[model samples]
Target chain A: MSFKDSYDIIVVGGGPAGCMAAYAAAKENVSVLLLEKDRDIGSPVRCAEAVGKDGLEKILEDNINPRWIAATIKKFQFVAPDGTVIFPQVPMTGYVLHRKLFDFDLGLLAANSGAKIVTKAYVNYLIFENDRISGVHVRINGVQHIIKSNIIIGADGVESRVGRWAGIDTTVHMKDMETCAQMTLANLPLDDDTCVFYFSQKRFPGGYGWVFPKGNKTANVGLGISGDRARSDSASARLESFVHDHFPDASILNKTVGGVPCANRLPKISSEGILLVGDAALQANPISGGGIATGMTAGKIAGNIAASAIKSDNISADFLKRYEKEWDTACGNAQKRYYRLKEGIRKLSDEQLNKTAHVLKDIPQKKQTLVKIFQTALIKQPGLLVDIMKTLNPFS
Target chain B: MILLHDNKCDFCGTCVGVCPENCIDLGEAELNIDHQICTMCYKCVWICPVEALFAEKVK
Candidate 1:
């Protein structure tokens, strides 16, 4: 396909957030162009490929295809630093996804909605008109082009350049960034319907390890350490030791490394003519570092807002504040609560974790709900009691 | 000075995100660092998962 001189809206990055934004905007009959830096929509999977079943269903509705799911998770276990396991009986369902396929499918949806998709199109910088964000300077196939747009959506992942270009403070502190490494391993025997998390300050300082099953004796084994704590050893080295100690006979299939922003959302996510979604806006859960569902949510909101802003021809930062207000009401508020809880959880020592596990072990498995577990874990930090209640409040 | 080992670098952009200077550009297949702009804070070097980045003294 050839290039266009201008578009009604330009969506950067082809991840879930980007595609969803394109899909929503295009569905509104606006001219949308989606740009992806990678050669493919989802070739290099950066995430652990897990999402809540309800969240996925809410976005895709009846279009939830089985092809994108690798494993259906029904339960999860938490391993304390002392090796004590506590399985909370929370009523939730999740899926280990084929992110490559899932992301590609979302892209297809956007294309079907009349959005133009372009891969390997690197956006070098943003174009400003009269000191207001106007468009972008993109380079594709060694040739550069300036594409003007009424609005720009920055759906780029953790390494978001668009936000920085627009003068938003997208910098993550060393203590808030999670330096991660993961390997897909085969022949590793694990429960197909269960996910496992290991917490150990000694092993994974300021972070944790996880084993997410992909099915049939295969899993994604990985861990993330806070940037401040990763100075002593690389994340790859830590994962290597973890894999060796846990699944000695498993064969490594693939290796991936990246960073996850575990901090709260940016103070500003929208400028005059640009809106930031996904990791660009730091929408990932602070405690769990999950962004797929939240990214999609942000994308849908941004896309819809972009369409309205274009139709009304009022693309000022003041008009775009609607996106920020709506986002905070929808998911950003919950993320703020999660960030508070994460801060509380980070202060727990290994001994405290072990003690919490021991205390939870005595309760009947059926009565060990997630709320109960958290209440016991944060018993010492009375201040966090209100945060726990607010974080887990279903009504709010 | 900051040095990046091509053999070890995966272009995953982990270092790009934490660079306070925002001087690193992650291309499709290669990672580039603008040394003139880099302050040698070593934040990227420390956060690199693969140990692909290094800090060296100028000879």
Candidate 2:
């Protein structure tokens, strides 16, 4: 069969957002193409692989695929420096995932919906015609292939080049970027149904550390320190030392280091015949740096919008703005609030965290919530009053 | 050029891991250094486990 040089929609990237976008676009029976630069769809994984059960339930179906899940969590613990642990008694569903399987399955779902999948395709630029995106110029198998498309979706992630090529401001401010380093550890016994968070200014200023258990004996231990404060310091080294000190007997099996965009949201997400989803649009959860569910949500919305626009023959920026509106209404407001909370949390010091932990320890575990955690953090730095008020306001 | 001595290497693999251009390659036994696509972020130098690999800042 001759390779078609055009598609109804070309979705760049095959991550959570890209996969969902392609799946939605193809489900409409439109000829779609999903491109992934990685040899394997989800190899060389990132993210801490923790997602709330309620959040997953809304997005995925019952009889959830076990291949994607490493374990199910039941408890949450946040420890401050000096090893003061505050057990927040909120019941939530958490999952440690096998990201490679999860991402690959999502891509396959898109393909099953009729989206053509291609790997090792590097998209270099967007093709423009008369102030509209016509398609993308990609190099696959060392040969440049130009695939024309009516609508383009950017699911390219933090290291995205598509948003820039499409003329969308994709720069991540150093202060807003979380420098992260993670390791899969063995021989560390942990609560199989509990995830632990450690906050220490010296170790992770402007960010925090996490231990998401894969089983009773294995876990993904990692930390994300705010890039701004770490300008002269090494966040990754600090993380490694902390891990060494905390888990002296554990062996590091694999390591992944990357940056997460902590920005609230891109002011604009769509342009003429083009749209951005997931990390490409900075849709990551502000405090946690988790975006699989959020990105997939945006992808589904973008696909629907693209299909509607194609049917109406109106794929202009103004027409595509509906995606921005719908996505914001669905999840943007919460992300914006979380961004503010993240700033507050980033500014906290080890002393402050310890103090907050001390206070939370006194409070009944059953009474603890994220709001109380923020309130306690703000107790020392009352200058963040406005933020506290905004946080207290449930309307946000 | 990038060279990470096994004895001195911390095995952090930060050299290969942080390379934006995917220049450095990590192997089980030794670090694979690629000079072709090195953007020279020097992030690896800061992250090396045993201070084995260092980058000469380009002038």
Candidate 3:
């Protein structure tokens, strides 16, 4: 698509969040432009590609395509440090997605909604007029172009520069970042419906290893360690050791590495005509580091708010503040509760984790649930007990 | 000084995200580190998943 001189809304990044923002804005009959720095919308997938089924269905509704799903997860297996296994029968189903196909479909949806889409377009910086975000200077196909927009949505991932360039404090503390590496292994024996998590401070200090089945005897095996605990070895090295020990005969197909911000959402996600979503806003789940569902939620809200503000001819920060308030009510508040639970869980020792697993193993399988497991594991953390109740409470 | 091994680098931009100085930039297929502002804190070196970045001493 040809670059326009100006657009009503410009979304920087072409991941799920950015595409949803563009799609939402364009559905409102606004001129929108979506820019992706990579050669394609979803090449070099960096995510674990897992999302809760209900969360995804809420956004896609009848539009959910079967081609985008790799595995329909039915259960979770938690392996404690001492090899004690605990089955947490989560009430809802999850899906291990084919992220490339899923993301490409979202981009297509945006295009079908009249949003212009461009790839290999790197946004260098933002343009300011009267100290308000007005446009962006981007390089496409090695050529520079200046494009103006009434509002800019920074859906860029963890390394988001758009937020930084806009003078928002997007800095993440070392401890809050999860350094991650994954390899798609084939010829592996695995259940097509179960996700496995390995918890060991010695093996994956401060984080955990995961084996998410992608169906067809293949799976994405990976591990993430907090940045503070990542000094001794690289994430790939640790993953290699884990893979070697567990899936020695499995052939490696693809290797990817990235960082996930497990911190709470940025204190300020909007300022003066600019809004940030997804990893740029640190919207991932603090405990699991999953952002697909929350990112899309925030993106949809931001896109709608941006379009309405433009219609009213008031794109000031005061008007954009509505985005933050709406996001807090939708997901940000729940995210805060999760962050607190994560803090409490982070302090559990290997022995404590093993003991918790043993305690849960004694319970009848029919009575096992996520809340019951958390209640048993965090019996001493009275403060987090309330946070867990608020976070997991169905009626709340 | 820090050196980047291009062959080993995956251009995943993990280094760019963790850099305290915010001097690294990940372009479409290239990664650049600005030595002028880098304090040699080596956060990127330690955090690189592929060990693409390393610290070097200049004579």
Candidate 4:
């Protein structure tokens, strides 16, 4: 009813990352409080909704509920600027989630795990005690209240202020930030459960576009462009025009806009009693701007570590650093590599994208894993070939 | 007014490629349609992975 004045762990932001952190921490029987700025559990959906099955399975077990999924992804298609398509063969892929439902469900799971959920509550600052994080200062309905907690987790999204409040340098450079816009349209004919990706400098310079089919002739269509190439153009306006031109007959459904943090993990993510997860930590997939799984994965580790540190009666920076190490080993390293690959690919021209598609199209559909496609792109640029060679080394 | 999130349309032409009336066109970040000739079937909305376009019932 009033502000939660105390808890074992306080997680800021009720997104995927925050939910996971609350769930995991509560699982350890810790008193956890999750604060969300939005009034509803899941409002203002900001995701493109396409996640690979294998990638998700790596983070979650098989028994996940089916209500969270909108559709199961079957095939993956890659397209060039001129529309040269390359069908990549892979095992079972992931799904396109109904984020509103999925996010709400995740919060409920955390609630069931004995975590407190507070909506429309904005965390204004970290409550510091003796130069260490002891709790959070939150504003709810114009009332400022301090919540004392042993640990604080920052999951407040791409341009997160929580990390900054915790004294973490969370600024994302323009080049590493992906500007995204999307819409849900109806009456558009598309293959059920197939996600299509497009690469072109004109449409999405230094990034790509995607169409994740959502059955019944509807889809979540969107594009991601790096901030460096965005200039002064309104990315949302651009997407509207594209839709009017391409699907003149498709009826409009809804629109959403947001930014995706394409940056790699921060140099440091732990400070005294604070831990960062999800987009707040720049844990999004570098190449695709997707973060559901990565955020969830890091959340699990961060929550566990926070509870353990509190139990051990130590909240020093050195003790909290284990959260970063565990998270980095689990998925941070792969994200860093993907970021490098994304940078390399960003340097390519539309013509290069077309040529790469041409070269890769020759590969049999059965052998079109992402690695092979990357290999094909590198073959055209000998210098890039060397970089690819270096990147290919597992140790690197 | 019905709108599209340009940043989200991947331009896979799923909307246009699949539009029976061929309403959707591909160019830059603009997912445009010939509004005068458009039908607003919303087939594109259902097919979009990024939810780039939406059909609004102008009451």
Chain A of candidate 2 scores what in TM-score?
Answer: 0.95
For all candidates in order, the CA lDDT equals 0.90, 0.77, 0.89, 0.76
Give model 2's docking category. Answer: incorrect
Q: Write the per-residue lDDT of candidate 3 for residues B1-59, one digit (tens) a residue.
A: 99999999988777777787888989877888999999999889888888899999999
Chain B TM-score of every predicted model: 0.92, 0.68, 0.94, 0.74
Give the per-residue lDDT of model 2 (tens digit) for A20-42: 89998888878899888766788
lDDT of 1 by residue, A1-396 (tens): 697889999999999999999999999999999999999997889889988888888877757999999999998899999899999886778999999999999999999999999999999999998888878999988789999996999998888999899898788888889999999999987899999999998889888999999998888899999999898999999999999999999999899999999988999999888999998888888888988988898999999999999999999899998989988988898888888888888888999999999999998888787778888988887887787777653211
- Per-residue alpha-carbon lDDT of candidate 3 for residues A134-250, written as tens digits (9 for 90 to 100): 899999999999999979999988888898899887877778899999999999989999999998888888888999999999999999998888889889999999999999999
lDDT of candidate 1 over B1-59, digit per residue (tens):
89999999988887877888899998778888899999999999999999999988998
Candidate with better TM-score, 2 vs 3: 3
What tens digits encode model 4's per-residue C-alpha lDDT throughout A73-160? 8778888999899987656567888889888988998999999999978776777778777888887876888889878899887646
For the predicted complex of model 2, DockQ is 0.11
Fnat scores for every prediction: 0.75, 0.03, 0.66, 0.00
DockQ values, each candidate:
0.83, 0.11, 0.75, 0.02
| Steric clash count of candidate 4 | 78
TM-score of 2: 0.86
- Model 2 TM-score (B-chain only): 0.68
